[model samples]
Target chain A: MCLKPQHYEDILRDQPDIGWFEVHAENYLGAGGAPLHYLETIRERYPLSIHGVGLSIGSADGLDTNHLERVAKLVERFEPESFSEHLAWSTHDNHFYSDLLPVPYNQHTEDLVCNHIDQVQTRLRRPMLLENPANYLELNDTVTSESNFINNVVQRTGCGLLLDVNNVYVSARNCHYNALDYMKSLPLQSVGEIHLAGHAVDDSIPDEALLIDAHDRAVSTAVWKLYDQLIQLTGARPTLIEWDTNIPAWQVLLNEMVKADLLLNQPPARLAHATEN
Target chain B: MPQKTDFHSRFAQALQDPQINTRPLLKPTGTANQRRRFDVYRNNRAVSLIDNLRSAYPAIFRLVGEDFFNAAARNYIDRHPPTGPVMAEYGGEFGDYMAAMPNTDSVPYLADIASLEWQRLQSYHSANSPVLNINELAKIDSAELVNLRLQRHPAFSAIQSRWPIGSIWTICTSDAESATSPAEVDMQRSESVVVTRPGLEVLTNVIPATGYLFLNALVQGKTIGDAAEPALTEDPTFDTGSHLAGLVALGVFSDINFTTE
Candidate 1:
């Protein structure tokens, strides 16, 4: 569950049975404040993971050095168990777009992403995970497939992957591809973590259904299926159920985590049988 | 066959301006409709940015109501997009932008209220520091008291406004009893407020003009005696010892340095 100040006392009071906590790296970049204060207190009890949304790792213009330094500082301070960022870019020409944007999967894009990841790992002195993006539009001139692009980056940089099953489902449904095929094709062995979140269906289009990664509602049934499929293949990795928008009550979010834990704890034989059919 | 840069540039242009046609940039994929897919991204960009502004300026949102605030925020975002990824620091310029907006002419005090909210935000996020105490002053030599320089806390800010912004902010943000109408506010009364976070909780105190001048002078590295000059000149009845005691009690100073001169 995403940490908020209003829920801090409750979290400390109840101390829910959670595996770990994840925070957006950008939110804690301030010099000092309540956000840092609470995070420091919470870190003493629970293992922390730093998930970066503003790194813009996929920008063709190259990574922002200042932003990388800020992330490095945060990593140094928190020393989180895991650090991850998205494959999509949100910044260009020094302007932040406030959303993860799609990039054409091609050799040029692969080289840019690899070089950016190398810089981050070098500065941070730690390996980071790259998340699969929930894409809306597919570039017509795209030369490489999404799976091949991610696999190539992992092979070259030796970085781990954050398999966001919800993103896969959203991108697949919107782009008209088989979500299972996409999940099955990814380099699951290199996946160090799993992300489950909710998405909203865009009803703007009359004929087609477009699922936007809104992270507002409960995790969709289809995403949970994809997540179960992924866990069957990769086994239980560190899983985080993200709820950024329309954040539900702490108990409701905890219930989602409980659901993920049940799936993660499933026996291998049972998961194998489930995966078969 | 556009290059990656050309494609991104065109895509960003389309995101900023819905009127721009991005169909030429796409590769002409067979089945799926590109326009509908691209519009989702456009809508997401606008919605997310507007929501961020609303979160940062809740009091402003409440004051202007949702429809007007959303309209102004949409216009402000299109003109001044965020230069960095820090959403908390994104709308610092919103107050100035609102002041110049044509629709805000009747509500001139709106800008000052926005400024007060921004100061509160800055104070909330500023660096933590150990506040100065009376014991720290006692440790200093009495002979050097006149030449001592005091540093304001990192989370300290002073806002002077023509309108009673402190009361206005309190009324807008709190659930306590307040005047039923905006006309109840006395616009002729000028007010100064000092915001400081001695601990984790941010406190805003409406101070007299003398207090504002004294603190402002001290923040500018003026000595205690020098800082008191303006305050006393403005208000001949101002008591330096009492004012100093009150400010110190408020945890305004973070450090005290003795001057060699």
Candidate 2:
């Protein structure tokens, strides 16, 4: 569930089967502070995952060692169950515009991203999860599909995939791709966790309102359906409800967790598809 | 190929120069009544930056109207993009930026207030290991006191200003209701404020000029005896007795490193 720093202890006091805790790795990157203090305390009890949004992993330039080292230290300190980052870049020329920007699906970009992922894993010395970004634009030509690119990364680096269901649904709707087709194409075996978030509709642009992945509201009627499809496909995996901005009360998140728990227990398809190999 | 930089270039353009981005983004065909498309990223970035500023400087935002604050904040972001990846640590130089801001010239004290805010944030995130015990300091003899190198908590920082920035910060964070006046501020007087985290929470206290000088020296490689020179010059009545006790109480000192004189 999307948790506030203030709510760390109280949430822990009443732990309700949270699969793991996802913290903005930057929050605890400092050498010493209560943020780190509480996170360390919580890490003692709950399984933790570092979800970084600012590493700019997909950038063409060399990977940010400073950022990597900070994340590395956090990994060393927390020793989280699984760590993850986006398939998007957030900065250029030192100006840190901390928002996830999409990358084109092509051989060159894949090669670049794979190298970045390799560096991250090598530094942390653990398998990290790469998430599918919620794309806002789609182009006519590409060397590979989004799922194909992800599969290649998994094949290359042995990194796991954090399939953000809401992101896929958002990207698919914004870019006019089949959400089911995208999920089906993914290497389901590489899937480690799932993220469910809320999105908002933009008002300015006509015929193409921005599908903002703002996690303030409830999982849309559409997203819930998509989640069901994913669960049946990927089976029960670790799930997180990420509400970053406009965080609602605690009960709101619990409700979402309960919803996910209900879906997890449901049986998967009887026939496990044979490997292509 | 140089085209490999396409991801980097396009992502950069999307961030600072979205207009240059000819790259086709996923267009949402179904929903369009109220949803703004590409503008979503821009709005989100702006909102995120502004929200971060609000958290960093609630008092300043409170002082300025939302409209004015936002307008200034947008300009601030354009000029001083965050070099650090962490958004909370983004506006480290915002106070200095605001002071030199051509537009925010009206609120002369705004910069000082921003300085106070910045210090508070530093205290919030600075490293605070266990303090050097009071008994530990007492163990040092006159013979071993020279060349003592002491390190303080990372959560500790001192800011001295002409304006009553500390009082203004105190009043702003608390519920004083009405706006503070400069005449009431005694801006002609100099003030130094130290921000530290004794426990889990951040605490800010106004320090005497003597205390500021003394700590400043100690933070440097000054010997305990050498550091006392600054405080004695600043105040003839400077008491090392209660002063050292206060530092210990605040979890300021970490350890004492000594070298032969």
Candidate 3:
């Protein structure tokens, strides 16, 4: 969710069952203001997850102590139920690209990711879940599959996986991998939270391919199908409705929240109906 | 492979130089249009930094139009990112960066404005202190006044500028005014602003050159007599009683300690 400071009050009032609120950690790093104040207020009412976009966990360069310290400080203040970051490396040399650029899923990248996870968990004094990237390129021919790479990070660092179903669809479309196969390859025991967000189709790519996780619109029917598959494979995990850009009305978000609840508690018969329909 | 420092390692690198090769670091030839994908990231980093600069110095952005501010902010972000993650401290050097900007020579006061805004944030975040009462200060006689070593509130900041800076900063940050005439603002004119968090809110109050000098001396841990000298030199009409009373009423200081030495 874009989770604007202005919208928090009305959202809590109108939609009390929204469960939890997830926010970009960087937005609240300031000393004091409406953003921090509102987040603190909302946090009192609901659980929160500190999701980071700037960590660049898969890069070859060393972790940024300054950024880690900021993250650690926030974790201390909020004492959030969960904290998560992307699998993508967003830096080259020492500069940081703010976007979650996809990482090559090789053994080296895997090891690097695991090490980064260890540092974050150590600094935060808590476990963090690593989310998958929405791939545009196939990434590495020599490296292990995406599932294996994610599993490796989870195994080595004892971190949890924030399996984004929409990402599975986006990557599968981008690289022509089967979404079902991607889910099946992962060690399901490590799965913690589930993510459902919107993805845009890269019009330039062939085979109507290349889905970019823009999180601007409603979750597409195809992504919902993939979500059904994952939920059936691994039942009853906490799901988040992520809409970062082009945020719609609170009702629209509530609709997504409703969808999330449906999938989580939706029984097998209902799951079949939810998936089939 | 180097030890994992933290998540910001790669993000910091990504912001530095775009051409630096990540081929050795990432998985080989995994998909198509790596450049296109990377562009999305490059765009995001640039945008975040630009947005941060605006947030840090809203008044400065308002002085210049949004278009101009966006351009200046972009340039500053590329040249200097937070060497540390605390964004409050990230843009502290932005004042110098703005001053050095060749294009910004048109607006000489922009840097000072940025500095003032940065001070506002510093004042907002600084350690909180309780206000000392006037009754306690009344107990101090002439000898104690001469030897006082006052404690300043953490959220105390002083900014001096050559332009109608305080007025300009106020106009820029507030919605009360519309257009500003660059001609009306004399380049040689000087003004000082003091940002203090007396209570829960941080306030930016316009101060005279006298007060600026006086406060600077106090900041340096000077005796009350020593501080009065420079302030007197700066403004012969420097009204110490009025200013001191006003500051006391505003709760700008805590305990005013007196030492015999």
Tens digits of per-residue lDDT, candidate 1, B1-261, equal 544456577778788887877777676666466777788788888898999888777778878889999889888988899999988788999988988888777777888888888988888889999988978877767666657888788998888989888877877777656554556778788899888889988888888889989888888988988988999999999887778777877878887865544
**Candidate 1 - CAPRI tier?**
medium
Weakest ten-residue segment in model 1 chain B by summed lDDT: B1-10
The DockQ-derived docking category for candidate 3 is acceptable
Q: On residues A1-277, what C-alpha lDDT tens digit does candidate 3 reach at each position?
A: 4466547778667656666778878767766544576778788888888888778787777677787888789889998889999887665565555566666666667778888899999999889998987776554333567777877788889999889989888877766778888888887767888899988766785655556778889999988878877877777777888887677878778788787677678766765554342
**Superposed model 1: Cα runs more than 4 Å off:** A271-277, B1-5, B30-33, B138-147, B176-181, B259-261
Off by over 4 Å in 2: A140-143, A203-208, A267-277, B1-7, B18-36, B135-150, B175-184, B221-226, B233-235
Measured with C-alpha atoms, the lDDT of residue A228 in candidate 2 is 79
Q: For residues A1-277, could you state the per-residue lDDT of candidate 2 as single tens digits?
A: 5447857767768866676788888777776777888887777777888888878888777677988898898889788888899998777767777678777788888888999999999999998999998877653335578888899989999999999988999888877789988898998888899999989876455555557788878888788888877777766788898888777777778898899888776643421321221
Poorest lDDT segment (10 consecutive residues) of candidate 3 chain B: B6-15
Q: For each prediction, how big is the interface RMSD?
A: 1.4, 3.3, 5.1
TM-scores for candidates 1 onward, in order: 0.94, 0.87, 0.80
Fraction of true interface contacts that also occur in model 3: 0.25
- Expressed between 0 and 1, the share of native interface contacts present in candidate 2 is 0.65
TM-score of chain A of each: 0.96, 0.92, 0.92
Global CA lDDT computed for model 3? 0.74
List the candidates ranked by lDDT, beginning with the highest: 1, 2, 3
